[model samples]
Target: MTIRTAFKSMSVAELTRKLASAETASLLLALVEMTGDTAPLDRWGKWIQGPTPINAEFPTAEAEEIRAQVADLLIERGAQTERLSEDSERFRALTAAATDRVIPDAEKPLVLKEMGLLDEAFVDWSAVRPDRADQFPVVIIGAGMSGIATAIHLERMGIPFVVLDKNDEVGGTWLVNTYPGCGVDIASHYFSFSFAPKSDWSRYYAKQPEILAYLKDIVRTFGIGEKIEFRTTVQSVSYEEATQEWVLEIRTGDGPARTMRAKVVVSGVGALSTPSVPELPGRGEFRGKVCHSAEWDPTIDVTGKKVVLVGNGASANQIGPAIAPDVERLTVLQRSPQWVNGVTGYLDSVPEDEKWVLSNIPAYERWFRVRTMLSMNDVMRPAATVDKNWDGPEGTINEANEKLRERLIGYMRSELGERQDLLDQMVPDFPPMMKRMLRDNGWCRMFRRPTVELVTGAASRFTENGIVDEHGREHEADIIIFATGFTAARMLSSYEVVGRDGVSIRDVWGEEDPRAYLGLTVTGFPNLFILYGPNTNIGVGGSIFFQAEAQSTCIARLIRDMIERGASSAEVRQDVFEDYNRRLDQEMETLIWSLPVGTTWYRNSKGRVTANMPWTSADYWNMTRSTSLDDFVVRYHDDERGTAHADDIYRELDSDVARTH
Candidate 1:
């Protein structure tokens, strides 16, 4: 049954029971949206208070009273009402109550868009579409979350597009990374797209298989599977100024290389595709099997075999605990300690009643998503901000960061009761939010196991049947798993991109330190867009899916504007690009990632924070919400070069709409 049908058919008693399992703040918000009643907010607003208001604990009697009121309101007024409240005042009030903070007037639109209440990303192609729009087709690389989102936008706009993937299936990283204990550290609700939400996720934090299944289901639901060219690798993309097209060289499954052309190219190939294994001496001499975490070989069983894992990062934190019980001996080589937060239900599944509320209630899922977005995105941002006047001891960046460090240390001490040795090895010497925070998935408890050992040092070399550490100590092993992460500093390193004036992107970006305007377009690359590009990775707050959506929306608007103006190509001005990067660098200095913390992939070799975005997700969203032609140098098919005024183009499109109707 449809959600509307399910919601209408729900009985009061059943709804009350399901609402009892739902988050109080989200339940109240959903009820207010459905019934246009702000009474519940005043009644239960005091109970909703915290960074994560959804997790707020209320008195037992008061909680039941709130649920009963919500049920009565839903049955009496919400089910009968067709038009919900669209008032700005009501929206601001509801959002403030749910988030436990004031929602500024300027930020209300962004918040509404995040709650899935507004469809700002939609473009009216019928009125603004150029006569030759059909001639300009788009080519999107990598059929992952970003590529799929871009394709869906193009499909809705009635634009011609093709999706290419190097794998045989969708889910780029999810399809490849099948290591043991592989799962998302972020909440499942926040990790999903706002447009296409999955309310029935099995776990609060989903695993690889389930997340991959969700992506595949999205592909099928949107009919995007037919438009994907699987097993096709784009080797290089060269822009041709003569024809105003991008020539893509691709190869398919051992097939000969072929050429294809498109008016626009969107690089959805994210920073984490290629694996980065450290160059250790005598690695070939080791007799044991070696494999990176991304390239896991399931057939190679570690049952009762000695295993030595390298690089105790995010993947290692999960992999060590997962394989500790099955393996005879597990040794983890750590270069530095990471700050891992202990989550209560890190491995627990979502309850059935909660899923029912999410699936059956009218606006419960949206409100729940909004709460998660607020809690996970910007609420924790203060802890990552640098304070130059901080007087705290070493390892802390600011007062907020020091408080977080203390809480994390207290949790670690409690987990490792008498094992101070392990606790010492696990406690990081840097701030809490410097690196990506990992969720505790039995990582601390695994250290208490007799068979598991934590080696504190880097691997210097490898022997015939063992690995040697920096201190010249050898650890025997039958298998060597490199949890060493990806080459995140190098954006789009898998393929070559030659832009205007025969300038290679590699030459411009060098080995690392990629700079982009709004993390979307480059200076010399005309009609090219990059999703999840440099300075786009979230270090402390927000979800990658949200970033992907923001970028895809901006790209769609740019393409739409190009067609509306009858422009052959559009490139960001060199001055605009440099100015953006200059501001981004200044902002970077205020973030924790720019501090001299332990070694992290967030920073490049030049000590610049190249991978992480310094702005809040809402800030980036507002910045990319619209495109201005004044920022780019536009050229027509007849070789006429000039920038079009946004006002003139909009007026012309409005006139066209009036004439057509």
Candidate 2:
């Protein structure tokens, strides 16, 4: 039923029940803030004092009647009737009351931007018009989250650009990683782009197919399909110093290679694209069906077969519970344990009434998204900070870390009951959030099953028919699933990138560690920007979509500035790049990931924390909001040649968007 009439069908008791929910309470607080109607909030008594615990229910019939009245009033005065400015006092009050934390006025702006409450302040055409926009074309490397967002904004500004991807589809990680029980860890609402909200999420944490559908819908809605080149791979990117242009060599499938030149290049190939497979001693002669989690083969069924799943990280944690029931016997080879949280709505579906409210309300979706984002972002930050004076166990960084460790242990104990062996294997020795924490996907319950076996020791080597652990025990298995994670530390492995003076990115960054200026621009790569680069991935909270959008907007602005000023190329200064990396490294030393030193994908071979950003998501957003011209050396058209490229009215191959240079 539609939202307008859905409310009319609800009885008073049902409405009261809906109102009693914590989601309803927080949403009502948002409603009151949006319209300045205190009637609904006043009806709740002191229940709205802080973040209402999910267990809190309406006490008496009188309270139910008041809540029903508020619901009726809300339906009568629809959200479309009024709009709330994010900077207003009422909005701040709503934020604080809904979040159950006092946010200072100084931090509101950053919060607003991170929450997507602020306006699109990235581009200002009035200050610097896109006069030479058509002449200067841009080439975006991927058609994923970052690429799509960049395309959308560039389309809005009437800039000419082309999106190329190696896959036959979009959605990057969402498209590729399709193992059983695959889904987003963050709330689906906050996981999406802020400018575009989805009202039809099946659950709070959406599954992979639903998210892929969302991205496909975005492409259709924005009419970006005509400009995207699917099944096209960029082989190498070389900067032409003489012409001040980026020469990209691309090949589509097995077709012949072709070259395209653009004024600027943006790399949107995310970090987790490459799969990292361990080199087992007898992997080749195992004579069993072997597959990585990311590259799951649908044809190879594990029904009633002996399965040995390697790695107990995020992917392994998910795969074990999903395939254990059907398999004859499941052996989980664990190198180390992970701390998984039992979230409230992790397994629940989105109710009909919540969907109705979100669809019907104007500002309600934004406020709800902000509430979830704030809940995930900074609430657990303090637990990861190091207190210098306070001595703590080697397993934990500080007092707060130790307390969190105990709470997690308590949670594990409650779930597993007297199964000390399971607890010992499940709980990590290090503090929580040291690595990417896993969400509870029935991981503990899987251990209780008779068919499942949790092996604590690391896999020593592979045998002819099975695997051997470090303790010299052999377990025969028909199939081996490497739930081992991706090569996240290997940034931009899709293609070769050469910068000024013909220097390859691999030569500079070696095999693993990659450093970039602001995680967007490298020092020597002129006119080349990146999304989801080194030190940009969030550890504790925040969505990668949010980070990608921020980087896209920043790059778009810098490219616009160059196009407006008739500049041929712009490279981040070397000294500025070094100084920023130095500060970033120093800051990394203070984060929890650096302490209690565990082996994680977040660090490189040298033990440098390359994957996670040390600061809050808000800090990264503030740093990338705008570009400083002084930090870059821009080469104008005059430096490249006396005039622009001789070709006029250039048409991009396989593209509807054409440009005249």
- The digit string of per-residue lDDT tens for model 2 on 86-174 reads 66766666655665567666567755664455676345553434557888888999888989988887877778899999889988888
Which predicted model would earn the best TM-score?
1
Q: How many clashes (backbone atoms < 3 Å, residues ≥3 apart in a chain or on different chains) does model 1 have?
A: 0
lDDT of each: 0.83, 0.77
Model 1 CA lDDT for position 333:
90
TM-score for all models, in order of appearance:
0.95, 0.91
Instruction: List residue ranges in candidate 2 displaced over 4 A.
Output: 1-22, 38-66, 110-117, 121-124, 127-131, 640-661
| Model 1 TM-score on a 0 to 1 scale | 0.95
Q: How far is 487's C-alpha from truth in model 1 (Å)?
A: 1.0
